[model samples]
Target: MLLHIDSSADTTADSVTRQLTEAFARTWHTAHGNSADHRHRDLSAAPVPPITPAYTTLGRRVEREGFVPPAKVPALTESAAEQREWGLTLPYITELLAADTLLLGVPMYNFAVPATLKAWIDRVTFPGALTDPDTGESLLRHTRVIAVMARGGGYGPGTPREHFDFQTPYLKAYFGSLGVPPENLHLVAAELTRVDVLPQLAGLEELAADSLARARATLTALAAA
Candidate 1:
């Protein structure tokens, strides 16, 4: 199963990451045909609310007491608010757990991931939910993540602004902690995405176009693979 997620605030033609992800999805679907199941989640559309105190409390309980089955949530939940939060969060966890391939369209927002996506991350990353508590093994070890990232400025190695790119590294670290090996995580990033609209970046339009083309090609190839 493939879980395609888009976090770009702009769900329009202007979003380079969205274009890349769309290309990826199309290629993937064409390659897999009816044999594959594809599920899409637009984080910006049906936004995942940020973690609440009640949610954290429930998460803490899970951490302290270990995993609990959904059928027993009523017995485990201490309050209505926690129950509601669990109701909201459980689907995200289940969706992720069922996915063999996670396709993420992530646009760099102020050099980091959008708060909407982070909220989803926070909700689903229960202590024992995505991992094996007793053995410290990650349940997502076999899953593959293809992150198509877009940045407004250049952040490649040796670039002056490279140090400012906090998006990809954070994703790598977060997924790594969740038990996804480096090889299972594929990153296809397009930089200088603002060149077409930003006056100062107009001179780098060629570079931006090249980057975007490369990113699109990579996404298609990865999807086909």
Candidate 2:
């Protein structure tokens, strides 16, 4: 299954990250002769709840104390709140595990991933949830993952604000914990988005379009791969 997750609150017709991810996902379906099993999650429309103490505490017990039947949870005691939170999160976890590939649409807001995306991540990721606590094995390690990102400004290695960019590196670490290596985790990103609309950088409109095109092409190739 192909899990396509979009976290951009920008519902504008010109939302680059959303366009990129959707195009990539569609290309994947086309590549598979329209038989691809694609699933979608829109984080912006329905945001995920942040981690709570009940969930965290109970989840830790599950991780440390170990499980009974379900590998996702342990055979430990829990409060009603924790169980309720678990009830909310288990379907997402199950869907993620069932997917063979994941396509994530991430827009850099304030130099980091959007809060909606983070909330989803917090809900799905906890110690031992995507890993084996007893053996220290990564359960989701083999899944193919790709991140489609859009940035308003340049934050590349030589850019003046290079160090200000946290989205790429942080996501690499976040998904890396779940079995996606730095190599397996690919990012097809478009930069200078603000330049596309701002009069100050109107001269760079062509450059922005070029960046978007390159990102789309990269996504297509990766989806095919």
- RMSD list, candidates in order: 1.6, 2.0
lDDT digits (tens) for residues 1-225 of candidate 1? 999999999988888888888889889989999567999999999999888999888877877776554545557789999999988888998999999999998999988999888988998886578875567678899999999999989999898888998988899999998989999999899999888778978789889989988998888889999
- Evaluate residue 31 in candidate 2 and report its C-alpha lDDT on the 0 to 100 scale: 80
- Against the true structure, candidate 1 reaches a TM-score of 0.94
Candidate that scores best on TM-score:
1
TM-score of each: 0.94, 0.92
**Could you give candidate 2's per-residue lDDT for residues 1-225 as a string of tens digits?**
999999999877788888888888878888886876999899988888888888888777876755322454634546788778778888788888888888899999999999999998888875566765567677677888898989988787887889988998898888876777677788778998999467766787787888888998899898777
lDDT of 1 at 29: 87
lDDT of 2 at 41: 92
User: In model 2, which residue pairs have backbone atoms overlapping below 3 Å?
Assistant: 141-179
